[model samples]
Target: MRPEAEPAMKPVFAKIGKPVAAKFRPDPFQLASLEAIRDADCLVMAPTGSGKTWIAEEAIRSVFQKGGRCWYASPLKALTNAKWVEFGNHFDPANVGIVTGDTKENTDAPIIVGTTEILRNQLYDAMHSGENLNCDLVILDEAHFLGDLDRGVVWEEIMIYLP
Candidate 1:
């Protein structure tokens, strides 16, 4: 890769690299959650329209601001794709990314939205033998999804293995 290529991908490590093209104006609750995400491990259990997703965006921005990375794990493939598209529009696609069952784009983006199963599998493989995920944050949206019998175990396994 060219020298410039590395710098472009280094938003995960660069404080102020290329200017991100878009801006986000989150609601009050999301703003508050965003502000608090840096200080503690948060469990945001709010109503559906309470801007819970923006909290994840704030976590993404925080990680990028600190020269770190965020892994946005969602419960469903549709949610993952939706987040990927949403963030892509709000941020430079080069700096935003996605990973689903069959679709992987801009894997080097500072912000990444993916499926919980994919993230869990990666964590499990990492535990057994893989590249260490040195991310600065992990936002578990729809936290109450641990009740779905089909995919609940994956979520439980992820919570158990998180370090």
Candidate 2:
């Protein structure tokens, strides 16, 4: 058999230009998430690129606008650091802080990003001190890690201790 063969379909060489600029509109589920977060605890589960981060940003925005505090926890330091920058861009650099195993800065900012372990430790400290966790809202990104074999305990502890 011949190893070389012509393409089955012609490549669209002309369709490779820059995509048309279009305004972004949230999906119905994203809108619903934003509404649900306003008055209640909400868990959003969607596929990648499905606007879960948008929902998070909006929730943080709502709280930040009202002079409230938000805690955003992810399972990894890399993700936590990325969100810190993203939230800083959306909410202003002075308003966002981060605390991980190796880094802690601006711990007094209105919006905080950190790993689940850090959050759990903070909860432990608050419990030990007889003080409440000073947070108005909490977002647990990569929340499915709650079922992970090794890391789930940290996430579970954070969930149990959060008020």
Candidate 1: give the clashing pairs: none
Could you tell me the TM-score of candidate 1?
A: 0.76
**Per-residue lDDT of model 1, residues 65-129, tens digit only:** 88898888998888888888888877667887888898888888777788998889878888888
- Candidate 1 segments whose C-alpha is farther than 4 A from its true place: 1-32
Query: What local lDDT does model 2 show for residue 109?
Result: 97
Candidate 2 TM-score, C-alpha based: 0.88
- The local distance difference test score of model 2 is 0.90
Candidate 2 per-residue lDDT, tens place, 34-150, comes to 999987889899999889999999898889889999999998889999999998888889999999999999999999999888899999999999998899999999989989999
**lDDT of model 2, residue 136:** 97
C-alpha positional error of residue 19 in candidate 2 after TM-score superposition, expressed in Å: 2.5
